[model samples]
Target: MEARMPDPVAGPITEKSDHPRTEGDPQEDGDTPRRVVLADPRSYCAGVERAIEIVERLLRDRPGPIYVRKQIVHNSHVVADLESRGAEFVDELDEVPTGSTVVFSAHGVSPAVRAAAEQRRLEVVDATCPLVTKVHAEARRFTARGDTVVLIGHADHEEVEGTLGEAPETTVLVETPQDVARLEVADPEKVSYLTQTTLAVDETREVIEALRARFPALRGPGSEDICYATTNRQDAVAAVAQEADVVLVVGSANSSNSVRLTELAQRLGTPAHLVDSARDIDPDWVVGARTVAVTAGASAPPWLVEEVIDALADLGPAIVSEHSVATEDVLFALPREVREV
Candidate 1:
């Protein structure tokens, strides 16, 4: 079957005007409608940018059938586009022919997985986000100090797996405050903590507090482990959710960061939905909503946001607005192989 591609780029859906609503000529009723608000820090993050760059460079320089260890990022559209361009995604190195070029996903990989790829002699390209790499380093540091490390993240995520591998025997995964309560340590005094870079900030805080209560001497990262991109996007969503009648998050269902955005909106007491693209938007939910907030996950492309806005425009004469909470300038460099090629 042919792979799917992202929606073709349409021109910018948002107008540059600062006005909340452009004058729509004098209405007979003498009332101007409110505009839809878009979150500024909504789209791709540095890690995601680097991941896509790796695939693009591979397609340009490498021959046919380059293997990727997992979804290049988390977006189906990105995976499909890369697959259409001759990239093959496999879950295991065993699936990749020996000596073939294979790129790792943005979510880092375990040492065992790396050893397996090395055993196969695959030409590997590491696309793990630098921020994730920092977490892996912290895990190793904690382990070296004879500390029982606690990892705050989803158990099965690729990034968590990789970080855990750095200190498997000592690392414990905690998803909630309850998990922290249930945790038993060989020595409470020697415990430290790290976390997945894309978790919900508020949820992670509660878990951290739980851990701190149990292990008074517990040390942690100088800053929160949740990445700036995740925090910023959530903050932007929350800013608009305060006023939006309904909120829509653009991303794949399996995407962790995307799911968090939807949950954040709902937690703020607003109805929110996660849609892979414009096609997933339900007209019924949006029909009566005077205001809607649209944001995208880190892996999601900005074009998807434009597509959703275009679809909303068809439903009614919509005015688009933007609310920017913060600016992000973080950038990650491509793997050496990709750069050299």
Candidate 2:
């Protein structure tokens, strides 16, 4: 079956549950009524909340030309809004004026980037998610104990770079079980592993098993490296994807967690698409799909989810239903600068 395409226009931001319906009551349609199920634990994870708060606070309290090292989060809407509010985003410290205020993206940064920022005397505000910070701490602990640390994550991701910096000489990046098999460690007894917070749970497990099979002494983190948010969102998608004819994941192409959601849905044998808004949706794919499931990534704004729902409602009457695989109430505290004040 062909996949549904996302709408091409940018959609409005709103809470996931606040989707607006068409003019009349949805039940009035004479055709066979199809149901639209929304994933309950779909949007805004705690880490994303903290990151956004950091940017919002910086904008409110600090002066113009505030520089951010990378996209604060993966969503273009969030980045565009920050840019409009006078935040400047750059790939490196040199792009930022010396001694200017700079906030690191939530994806975190390598030690090299941090050193460069310090050399430039940039006033730094670290907006790295606390969960990602946990991975970094794990890398340090393993290295301090004379262990070779295997980091299971996308090698080029900013978060992976930052975590790798904690113990670069001792760290090895593994994206698949194949990578694990070829890994060269100093000693089987002195190896530990950590993961990027936003990795797919099942995929990570396969890699972890591969490492364990190669080295029985391999150590794992006290808790899983994949954060609660990533796990929960994927679980929610998996729960509903089986019942729906099509699945729509609200997220950007570059969003790690969002891409994982789309992958999970497709793995369940349902057609899935990752879109930023309703404009990205291709009506052709949904033409015959009777039931559709909608979800959003952690960094995705709820508004985009609602816009997709609104667009779908315009095509025909939609009986919205809510489905949740798990309940999440996790909340991360704001940075010291924001909380203390």
Candidate 3:
């Protein structure tokens, strides 16, 4: 069945009682069923797909030990898969044998890293998500205008790090509303803000509000920098969280967007767990949950999400359905280097 369009103005996100009777479901309870509701637009955003494809194509076309600077998008499964294909994951460009081909992760990289790769004369294939690159562009433009850029994102996040490196001397990082309060900018009147593309939308909004309150003249991106995938998945969770007794998010602990989905569900008063795969789904967590909401991080592969659904099935028979908040049609073109490949 087609999903109903999400109406944000709709009342509290509520769980429905239309559960299917699972095999092991103690017949003691009434006809309430045990089921899993899958969130649409859940995994492998355009950027992640492009990043992974870049490596796959590179592997097919090049004779390499193709080196990737980061996890290539933060999913353990993805990195492992690429590793099995002869892609070397490294923390630094120095690890690449000077002349070997190298790829930057989808998370983007600092200018210094790019310079390092160039200095080593390494053949580079950049797989930075176009949306993240947009944030970096904002940072450069704001700093060039003499505005002190206040980047609202986790301090250590790769996306944030790359954006900060755009104009480090002119950019400052703030993670929360409180950070805005304690921030001491050189000129409040000339301040601007940008954000990590995958941050939790609601939390980032609060931080933005805090920044504006402190500096009424604060500037921000002409259009918000949080990517469509992040907003869509977060909104998708909001639509189903109210109806789910419990929510299970599939992705690595370090996946910011995946973690935010868990946080979003929790904020709605539902118990949520962040799992790397089906292996982490604790049978104990779903003890009393009649309906479970399943979603995957933007960087996560669909296979992991499927594995989770299978794991949930072992708990009992489940009516798995897709709860789509919105349809996503965004696509980014491959980098020029591999466009022909």
Candidate 4:
């Protein structure tokens, strides 16, 4: 199902003023609030919240060690926090004991992984994002129609891997438009395309355009595969990046959407960095920057954003305002496995 979020142009909470502190002046001595623009619709999409809650409920209700396959979400801090509370994250199903409860990650899994879990008799609680599940369903549908499916995303990403597994024999992964030229389909006229939910919108559009050029009869999902959260965050970043000197995206290194935010800001001619936390922020990056824009990925926790602002405040008195692009009120129901508990 699609996220129930409104798509709108970003509106600034307050009018930004010129830098009160000059380059030659000391940042610490500034009397004005240091400009910090926080992007609205940042952090913890509904799918991520659902996944984390499923694990938390299982940990609280069940006494046994709760096993999770891969990260419940992409954030390292989230994984570490859960690990401290007795959630065991594993690389493979073999690491989990037979007949024990195991939660699949939010990225979803291939049919092979599900079959492997079945063989081991692991009690499974799927935490796959509904959006990702939608992509998988599309893959299966296209493949069943005897169409060669072209998946757009990084080959190594967990989300892409799971989606690729949906129709391995019929599916091909393409990261860039250049890969489209080398693609070979059994029936050129009967090809369809799908994208990872977390890819950059502009880049994915380019790739889709290339695919259409190569195969004019290309089929696709009824709606774009990029989730609403990803699109909104990118739009927010683009808005702040234009007015900010430097942009800092709060999320782990492996988070695809977080990295996309940094890249988007850089593409807009603003210096940007992907920081896991405030400590990762290079002091130099913000020393001369008057307006520092901050945003978090879907997997990132909201508290982390506050911490970054606190860290920035340490440098000087900061004026923090949110530039909201959209309001997100979407909520996904807890999986049946953990719903009652």
Which structure among the candidates has the greatest lDDT? 4
In model 3, state the lDDT of residue 32. 59
lDDT of 4 by residue, 1-341 (tens): 43567766868566434322222234754565568888877999999999999999999999879999999999999999999999999999999999999999999999999999999999999999998999999999989989999999997899999999998999999999999989999999999999999999999999999999999999999998999889999999999888999999999999999999989999899999999999997788888677899999999999898888878877766777778888888888878878767
For each candidate in the order shown, give its overall lDDT on alpha carbons: 0.85, 0.83, 0.85, 0.90
lDDT of 2 by residue, 159-211 (tens): 89899888889999999999987889899999999999999999999999999
Give a tens-digit lDDT track for model 1, residues 104-140.
Answer: 9999998999999999999888988888988998999
Candidate 1 residue-pair clash tally: 0
RMSD in order of candidates: 6.6, 7.1, 3.9, 3.1
Assess candidate 1 and give its lDDT. 0.85
RMSD of 1: 6.6
Give the winner by lDDT: 1 or 2. Answer: 1
After superposition, the stretches of candidate 3 with alpha carbons farther than 4 Å from their true spots are: 1-32
Query: What TM-score would each prediction reach against the true structure?
Result: 0.91, 0.91, 0.92, 0.95
Clashes of 4: 1
Descending-TM-score candidate ranking: 4, 3, 1, 2
- Model 4 CA lDDT for position 114: 99
Q: Ten residues in a row with the worst lDDT in model 4? A: 16-25
- Which residue segments of model 1 deviate by more than 4 Å? 1-15, 18-34
